[model samples]
Target: MRNLQHYTDDAFEFHKEVLKSKNTTKKDPSYKERIENMDDAIEGQFSAYNDNFVRNTLENIDSYGHTDDEKNDLLKLYSYKNSVIKNLKVKITTTAANRIINTCPNCTISEINSFDHYLPKDEFPEFVVNPQNLFPSCTICNGYKNYIWIEGGKRVFLNLYLDSLPAEQYLFVNLAITGDVITTTFYLQNNGDINNDIFEIIETHYNKLHLLERFSANINEVITSLENTIISFVGKLPLDEIKDSIIEKSNRDRIAFGHNYWKSILEIELANCVEYMNRFVTID
Candidate 1:
């Protein structure tokens, strides 16, 4: 997973903008005013999240229980997320979706087109429009992560904005070559360098998101791309030189993505696999 720059928009101001754009014809015309009156309370909840987030104790914050009518209104704010995103004045959500790295930070597998509420809006309605709580995500990871955040008093998902991903290698892939078929299996191990607590969370992250399975399912495409690269060098470079080129590419990707990036990790593994490298040497 990758770290992201957190949004700096003020919570109350953002809510006001969303509330202003909401269609108030169906509900109490004063509904907007009613919601606005809760500004202090909303800011308190925002502060609660900030404090607990810094302490890595977000689980300590309880879900706010509001009156049925009020809860409905707050939930509607989240529904207006698209409006919030599209509004030029409210660029916080849009800015997040347009980050330099365009992939979902949670999986780095797909393009991100939606925002995921780190704290599900249903549970934390007061934070419905809080940019700090919204993360840019692909629909797939967003659905897979749906409403599942913590278990056993530990965070099952990492807050990319708050949690600093480990620089050390933890995610690994083991390639099994059987005759002409190759199988890629991705797994996570602490690698003796990561903190035990951090690693536990990492394990939960992979399991909860089914990342290993997803990575394995998609790895064939990466392998095919690598094979195509090797095919181009078959007659032009020796085996060692070809392996070095693959390593160089992997290194570049690791810098562009991260150490645990699935593609880069697999590329390095393929580079070191003498048997796999030899397949390129004799390609027709």
Candidate 2:
């Protein structure tokens, strides 16, 4: 999820929106569960999260001698569940730290537990509403890669908000007609400005997000196109002729031709996808 920078008022407005939806959820599936989950999430945004939070609040109230302002502050904090009715006396005054509030952009879920569908709420509950926690992934992506906890050793929750590394190199190649393919080499000789940075980002994106390397990613997607062309040629032949035609076409090694076309298409789609990648890797 991209970082969301909202004005102070927007957060309160977001809370009101949450309340209205919560009130109207009786028309949908698992309304009670949804509210409970939302209530928990809301509490996390406030002070104590889930059950641990409630116990802590009670303990705090009992242990400390309260000032008049402290009692009033707690009152406002308690009323915040209503979102719209949150008394202004509860405005956050302590830190100038930029808050990184987040919620999954894809959260249209009607079920309570399903609300944090894309977020690792069970593990990283504090980051549940953090914008960095939200990723622009497909539903299939979110479901398939659920809580990708890389096990073994000291287990830590997987971080999507990783600092990307610089690009070491980026180069492209095409098979030569009769000789070796063009050895397009982009070297990380001198220190280019952002080469390493871009590389790090791509590497992280590749490993975490499963974006393939250029050789694997770019060439593989066109295998079907190559198959289609070869099949079409063979389909026009007799049974005995089909085998020969298929062999003949494949032996010609037109996979290079397919690669050329694919590379051109990719360049058109994102002009700097290859060139900029190389530029960063190649130091002056």
Q: lDDT of each prediction vs. the true structure?
A: 0.80, 0.33
Q: TM-score of model 1 relative to the true fold?
A: 0.90
> Residue-wise lDDT of candidate 2 within 33-134, one digit each (tens)?
443444544444533322222232211211122345433322222222344332221222111353322222222111111212133544444333332223
Pick out the ten consecutive residues of candidate 1 with the lowest summed lDDT. Answer: 88-97
- lDDT score of residue 213 within candidate 1: 89
* Local accuracy of candidate 1 as per-residue lDDT tens digits, 140-200: 9889889989788778888887887899999999999987788888999886999988888
Q: Give the C-alpha miss distance for residue 152 in model 2, angstroms.
A: 11
Best by lDDT: 1
Clashes of 2: 15
Residues forming the 10-long window of minimal summed lDDT in candidate 2:
108-117
lDDT of 1: 0.80
Clashes of each: 0, 15
